[model samples]
Structure formats: C-alpha cells, structure tokens
Target: MATSNLDLADIQATVLRYRPEPYYGTHVLLRIDDARGGREFLRRLVPHVASAADWWLRDDAWIAVTLSYAGLVALGTPEQSLRSFPASFREGMAARAEHLVDVGLNGPQNWEPPFGSSQVHVALSIFSGDQLKWRQAVETAWAQFRDLRGVTLLMSQDFGAQPGDRNSLGYKDTIGQPAIEGSGVEPLPGQGRPIKAGEFVLGYPGETGVVLTMPQPDLLGRNGTYVGLRKYQSRVGAFNRFLRENANTAEERELLAAKLMGRWRSGAPLTLAPERDDPAIGADPRRNNDFDYANDAHGYQVPFGAHMRRMNPRDTRLAQLTDVNLHRIIRRSTTYGAPYDPDALSERDDEIPRGLYFIALSAKLMDTFEFLQREWINKGDFMTLGRERDPTVGLQENDAVFTIPKHPVRRRIHGIETFNVLRGGEYLFMPSLSALRWLANLGG
Candidate 1:
C-alpha cells in the first residue's frame, strides 16, 4: 500500500540553516495536518527543530508544517519533481491519534477538497546576508530535507525595513503601533474573542481576541484568529502633484496630509501637537495610545475621519461601536520601492513603482478588515460634516474625485484625487509548523 510519510531526516536537514534568530530573509509558510499516528510523529519531529527559542518560547511559534491550503496544492504538481516516501511512515501516522483540520485556505472559497485539514503551520525565513555562506548552509540543509516536500519557501524579495519605510502608499507606514508590553496604562481586560480550551494550550493564550474562534471539537491549537495580507500599489507621484495643485499654501498641504494619516510623516500625531509636528509624542509609547479626538476644536491636529481616528477613534463618549480594541489589528507592513526624490516630485508620470505589503493579524476580519474598508477607508460620508477623506487609502465611488472643503482656519483644498489601488489578495490562515508537515505528506 502507498504510504503518506516522508524521510524526516531529509526534512530536518532543510530546516537547520535558519537558526541564530532574527530570521534572514525568504519566508516559508507551511500548513499541515496531524499524521494518522499523531503524538509519535510530533515526538519524532521535535528534535529536528532549528530554533529552541522560537519553537518553544514564542506564544505564536509552532513546530508543525503549515501553509494556506491552495499553497500546498501548488507544490503537488508534476513540475515540482516531487518524490514520495514509503508506506511504513503512514503506518506510524495511523497508529498515533490527534486532531486533523485544514490549517489554511478552506474550500468553496479556497477551491478543491481533500485539502489537508489539521491546523498546524510553520513560518520560516531563508537568507541571503552572507552570500556564499548562506547559500552553502541552505544547500546543505536542502540536500537533507528536499524529499519531505511538504514545505514551500515564500522567498521574500527582502525583509524590508520595519513600518516607517514609505511603501507605495505614498506615506510613511506603521506609525503609532502599540507596544508589545508596557503602555503605562493597563490594557483593557476584555475577553474580546473566545476560543475553546484546547486552543489555549497550542499557541494562542492571547490570540483569543485577535482571531475568531472556530466551533469544531478539536481546536487543535488552531483557534482564536485570522491573518490577512494585502499588497497595495501606490501612485506616489500622483499624490505629490495633487497636493501641489490643491492646497493654497505649503502649510495647508502638509496639514491635510497629516490629517489623512492621523500622524505627520515625521511620526507625530495631529491630536497632541496640532500646530507643529511632535516627534517626541509620536515616538512615545505613553502619549500616542493615550490620544482620543475629544478636544480638537480646530480639527487641525487630527480630523474625525482620518484613517487613524476611524480605525481607532479615541472618543469614548461617542458610543457607536461595541469596543475600540475589537477592531485593533497588529500591523506588520513592509514598504517596497525606491526612495522618493525631490526632482521626481514634479513629474506627474504614473510609472513610479512603490507601495506596501499590508499585513494585519486580527481575531475577526469582519471588524478589522470590513469595518476599515467599508466604514472608514471607503466611506464617502465618514464624518458628519462631510469634511475629511482617508487621504491615503480612500477609494472614490464611480471613480469620482470630490474635495473636502477646508476647516475654518485652513484654506480650501481643491483638485484632490484618489491616489492608490488595491490590486488583489485573499484571506490566509497561518498555522504552526507541525500542521504544515502533516499536509505536505497527506495523500501518500
């Protein structure tokens, strides 16, 4: 009988190169199921792990192989030159028992069935830093593990700098991100999203509110959330030209840009220090999270419908939604493109290549993704006065370009236009590594 197991030694070798933390480059996401014989397979796989700190320590880290379901099928084609393992491994898998759920890309929405069902996943990074050294290590690792065939390397173009680097979005990204721990004020103790008991032990003690919990009996350490990735292509030059043509004064243009983003390009929020950019408050953990748009009479510091305000409005008195934290997502956006030049500012040529790979992890895509897109980013009438638009990410209906007349103190901004586009993306599930391997060798 054909078996669904691969040589673990081969898999282990491919995994050893990514050690020493601070992952180098090239992210690999694997979605897996628990092999028929479960705990024994996990026991066999645990010794081969590359990072002890990452594998065991981190709350989100996992030992299972994982991937989006569609992503796994892509590796199944003949062109990949895949080889299968012997029948004996399947015997081992069938003996040990554990949960099996598709970790990524469910069917109907995801396409095709017999997709691996267990929710184990693993995300790893491939490197290019030391050139020959990195290549040598990768080759050595590949020689050992290529036979496993469950793993797929994402091969990121670059790690890309953390949040602030300008993506195609035409503005600095990832500003006002919350601290992992100390924010001075206590975090609201809300059991925002509830997962089953088993999931809590797998990897998500805190992921409850970040990802929606599922109903199936075996949470299998795969509950409490969803992960979304959007690659946005920005028209940078178009934005610059629009600013020049619209605002009467340079100060007026800068203020408008700041209002759209909720913070200045320098990382300052308009709410705290409205008149001027405050790099100090922008960088501070205490003040940034503490801001609510309760007292901005001028609307100069931060407008009511600015992307930040619409996404995380500080106005506690205005009881419009269930809770503010319900919509909060942990953003991990990376900018892709060249630095903007002053000379290029005047060129209205639309060929500039820039944008952001927007990644957000949340408990519910409904609140985090839908709310932001429909209610805030794409909402034409987000504000009661019909004044502000999400300057950076707003989409105009029927491709209509309308203007938001200026505040009383500020001059009118005219000739405004929509400057970005959402190319394409699908919702993805990120599972721990153990889940990834089970899917890779599922059919035998």
Candidate 2:
C-alpha cells in the first residue's frame, strides 16, 4: 500500500522547520484558570499559530503553541482522549523527578518554579528577527488572556543574543542536527542517512518501519510531536579552573576542551580534524557533520564518552545494536543570561547567571530523549568505558574522571566538577495545527 503524503498545512512549523531564520525567541509558560475561558483563548490564538507550510513563505517571524498534558485536560479533552497520549507527557517531568536528580537536575530547590510542577499548563513560543517585534507579539497575545481570566503566565524566558548563536561556555553551538527525510532541508554531507520523519513527527514511518500508533481522531495526533525543555546553569568559574589545573599551557587547555566536547570551540568535529582545530571545516556545512566514529572506533580521535559521541555515536559500533538512529532527536537550544568572562571570575563577587535553554524534540519521549539521558549520558558502560560519564554535561561527583585514549596510553582527567546545573524544565506535547482548532472548539 502506498503511504499518503504529509499535510504540511496540518503540521506545526516547529515539528519540521529546523531553524527559524536566525531569530530571537521567547517562551511563555501558562497556567489555565478556567476550562471555558482557556478554550476561548485557544480559539483566538489558533489563527496566529504557524504551520509547516508557513516556514518557506515567512522570513520575518513566527509563533507556535504546545500544551502540557495538563493543558490538554484543562481545555476539556475527555479522559479517554487524554489516555491515548504518551505516559511521559501525561505524567509530566515530576514522574521522573528522582532520576532527573541523579543526572544533576537537582539545583536550588527555590529555583524549581512551577515548570515541572502541577501549575504549568501551556507553552507559547514566539520567534522573530526583531526583538521588539517578538516582544510586541507576546504582549498582544498575553492581553487576550488578561480580560478572559482564563490563563495566567507562569514564567517567561527571552532567548537569543546579538550574533546570537553561542552558548554560555562560548562555543559556536547549534550544530550537528540531523535532517528529517521530508522536512525540505537537505542532510549535511556525511550525515549518514536522513532520519525517518516518523521519528520526530506523527503519521509517518519511523526507523522500525512502523507508522507509530497515533491517538484516535486524526486531527489530534497527526503531525504532532513531543518536547523536553531544560534550563542548564553553566559554571564558568569551575570550567576555567578545571582547564587551568589540568593543562600547563593555553594551547593544551584549548585541546583539552575540544577533546572534552568532541568539537572545537569553532564547531569543528575532532573526528575529521583530530590533529588540530580546522576553521574551514567548521565553517562549511558540507564538511562539519560528515565524519562518524567508524574510522576512530577506539576513541583515539574523539573520546568514547565525549558529549557529542554519547549523544549520537553515529555509525559507531555498539554491543548488539546495529542501528542507533532510533535514538536520534532534533535539538533547538538557546543561551540565557550574559556571556561569562573567565578573566573576571575571581573579581565577580555577585552571582551571575548564564547557561542554555535546551529543547529536544522527538516522536517518543521515552525511547529517544529519556533513553539518551539515562543510558548514554548518565552512564558509560554501554560505550565500554566503565563508570565514566559525559565530560561536558554529565553529573560530576568528586570521583568523576574522563579518559582520552591515545596510541601509547590513555590520559585520565580526575575530579571533573559538574559545569552544567539543571534549574527548571518540563515535558510538553506540541499538537498539530488542526488539533489546536479542535482544542479551541472543545466544550463550546
């Protein structure tokens, strides 16, 4: 049987659109007050929601909305309808609260906020090239709920900076994302294969050659996806201190940082340019993500437990696993707070906040996002590297150590302090464009 074509008009733009034209974004977390009022708010907001078809035509700005599992129920979705959604979404991030702590998600208790808590309901994402324009749009949207008394804005974060792509640790970030088969974006050279669209979008065939069972009533499930949003607080002082302690010269420190991340600060991968940083390769999209772990299987070039390797491991041989593509996900991250200055670390008396707002998208939350966190990131046994964790983002204890395999003998770095601290986050369901309309009409 022939598969049907994807309805771009029915899909949300964020599900397929990789980059939003180098724009600034603001994420607003909302709590629904009244069911009827909330539905009315959705009714008013649906027309402004961007669709997959709008990605090509628009160049200036866009907006998208996703509902938490609680948000769906608050909008008057039936209990039976809610049951069809994934357990991860329905249970929220609190369900995995314990494991999250084990993986360094435990930050200051007061900073937890209402994100993964019961208070959070809806998420509104606005993107625009002009910061003023995006802020105006957000204010206009917030006005609709003000009079209705239907929704309350829980928290908001403004993301993106001038020349706005670098993360807090100051590396050229947002590279190495896989292209979906039908997303109109071509895969970078050496990206292996275009990931199955169904892996990230509903109503499509995934890596397992299955369409992934969707919720009944096509409007609600087709073209929908799931998201995991996390805020990481970067410890610049600790990172600089680690490098100073580990390496003697500035050159060695740079090399050590590159090995730890599997990529140079210029965004170049070590697998391709193991000897030194190559600005030319990092600048070229064709050459950047082209290399895999097949040639450097022993972790000589790129360490086995590097952040990039643990996250993807593309083409790397795993025990009893032929294809690791099933675990791939699309990441859309933005840095928060000001850039950190290593030289001023000692004199900086006050607490200066800076890190990343990490956003990950996938069709199945458990198989892709959660699995990567638990198996690959938090643990290292699968990669044949004993108890060592990811050097870049892993939860580092006093005994934490990272091994860099060399021809003669491996080099080990010990007492690696955790640099990225999790502050707040949540699991949300980004529904289809048609589903947004359905939600608006519900209980009317």
Candidate 3:
C-alpha cells in the first residue's frame, strides 16, 4: 500500500506554493452572529476557494479560507465533529497565553479584541498580481455576505509589498524554508534533505513514517493543515540605532546584522560568505540555501543563536539527537507597512506601524509551530548558549547578550532589545478544498 494518500487537487493553494509571485494580498476577519446564517454564507462562498491545482497554473487571482475554533462551532458543526480537531486548534492561541508573552507577543492586556479572544470566526485571504484585481476578487466573492444578516466583516487588512521577497526590515525573508517532498519545488544544493509531504499535509507519513492521525471523516482531514497567523510590528528605527551603536563602519554594520540573522541583507548565508556580503551567491538559487552549520559548530561563521540557525538547525549535532525534520513548517509571509527611510534613521524616535503578516503551516500546531516559538526561538539553552536569545526576533531586555566565538575568546554584545512585537494572531484550521465544500453543504 502507498504510504501517502494526498490528492493534490483536494488541498488548498497556500499549503504548497512557496512563493506565488506578483503578490498583492489581504486578510479579512469575520464574525458569525448566527450559526445557520454562517453556514449559508459558506455555501455561497465555496465556489471561489482556490485549490492546490489552481496554484499550479499560476495565472488567475487566488483565494483561501480558514476558520478559528469558534468558527467551526458557530457554523453549526456538531459537538462530536468539533472534538475531532487537534487540541491546539480547538483550545486556540489563547491556550498558549502565558507562552505568547514569553515569545514577545504583546501582553494579553494589549491584545487586539477578537484575535486571542475567540471572537473571530472566519479568515479569508485573497491575493493577485494586480492590486485592483485582488480587491475586485474579494469584493466579488463577498458580495452576498456583505448584506448577510449574521456575518460581519470585523477587519480587513491590505498588504502591498513590492518584489515579494524582502520584509520591512530590508532583509530578504523566507530563504530557509524546507522543500516538501511533493511540492514540485526542488530542494536547493544546501537545503539538506527534502522533508516528507506528511510533515505538512494530512493523510501522509511524516518523519516517523507513521501517518499523522486525522479527524473522524477522511474528507474533512485528508488534505487539511493547521495554520498559525500573526501580525508582527517591526521596530526599524530601533534596529538601525542598534547597528550604529555596535558597529562603526557601514561594512561592519552589515556583518553585525548578518550575525544577528545568519543571512546577509541580500540573502547570502553567513556559513558561505563569513567575511562579507556576497550578493551574487545570495541571488543564486542553487547556492543561497546550500550551506549548513556542521563545519562551524562553534558558530564562528553563523552564530548558534542566529534567527535562522535557531529556527532550523539543519543536519547539525542537534539533529542527531532530535529529529528536526518533524518540526519543519512552511512559511508564507508578506510585509504590510511601508518601508522606513534609511536616510531618516537618526531623526526617528517614535515607532512605525510596519511589519510582516506572518503565517506558518504544519500538520500538528503544537509539535511544530508552537514548539519552535516557545522552545527554540524564545530560549537558547538548547544550543548551550545559556540565557542568550535570538537578537533578530527573540524576546529580549536591556540585559540580553549575544556572543560571537573567536579563537582566543568570545566577544559579547549587550543591551539588546527585541525588534519584533506580535500585534495580533490566531490558530486556524485550513481545511481541504473538498472539506470546504462538505462544510458548505453541512445541513443540506
């Protein structure tokens, strides 16, 4: 019997497409006032949902729909059916409330209403190359729901970022993602090994060769996956100030930044070009993700605590003990706010409302996404680095320190502050394309 049971046509587009180009996107959060009315709304919206097959064509506008724990219940899903979902999704992001604060999420007191509060029901995402086209697609799809009695569009966030690769912080993002076994995107030279398709999609064997448990009905869980969505607010002015205070020259500053992120601003890996930035190497698809930390175990070239290394410790000693492959996640991030002016770095004091709309997909929410945030990114003891945290995205205070291992002794940088703050987020169930139809036709 085949170990994999995935029908690519049944999966959602976002689960596999690493980079859907010409990207202009929006996320609309909705609240369902009445269970019956909400189910009716889904009935009308099913035709617009894009599938994995749709993404392969890479031409027309695309849309995906996911639901919060409250969403499934609000849509009249039976209690038994609701119980079938994973605990992480069912209890929702609030279950990790205390952990969220430790990971630098804005405290519970400051969390936006309906985000961690279980008030949001539906999450609709629409993306396209043309801004106007994306907007029209959203409007056309939600036309009926606009006046529906029980459905309310609580918030609609517009994300417009050019080039579709770099984040608001001026660094190339999404350079270290694992290539799923069946994603069609080939693994690069230094990307290590191709992760199992089951690690991401349901009904397939993950690293353990045991198929992850699916919810009751096969159709509802077969091609489905869990998603963790968070909106990050970047502190660009503060980051620039830190570099200025730490490094004297522009070249030195770039190198320091590379130490913090494990990749140059141009996407070059520090392990490959430890001395300086190499734009050509970073730009080459084959070379950018072709290096690992085995040779630089002491983190001389790539700091052990660097954001990339901490997130994905590819084929290192840690991998020997723990299966890092099981913890892999597919990231789909987009910058929301305008880029900060590099020239005005000195005059800026106030914070800017710009950062990434972060999204990560995996089969098990707690085992992968939550584990990474709580155990790896927020803590550094696993790498034997002590209390130090990831300078790029870790939770930090004035006393935070980052050490660079030199031959004779180590150099330490102190007074580090967190540059990324979580504004809002939620755990959602990204059901299969067929499951979506089943949800729409629930009662009828």
Question: Of 1 and 2, which scores higher on lDDT?
Answer: 2
Q: Which ten residues in a row have the lowest lDDT in candidate 1?
A: 93-102
Residue 243 displacement (Å), model 1: 1.4
Task: Estimate the overall C-alpha local distance difference test score of candidate 3.
Answer: 0.78
Please report the TM-score between candidate 1 and the true structure: 0.61
RMSD of each: 11.8, 2.8, 2.7
lDDT of candidates 1 onward, in order: 0.42, 0.77, 0.78
Cα shift from native, residue 220, model 3 (Å): 1.4
Name the regions of candidate 3 deviating beyond 4 angstroms: 1-5, 57-59, 100-105, 162-164, 343-350
Model 2, span 22-104: residue lDDT tens? 55778888899889989989988888887877554434556778888888888889787889987766777766655554433
Query: Tens-digit lDDT track for model 1 on 190-236?
Result: 21232222222222333343323331222222432344544455666
Off by over 4 Å in 2: 1-4, 20-22, 56-59, 99-111, 162-164, 320-322, 344-351
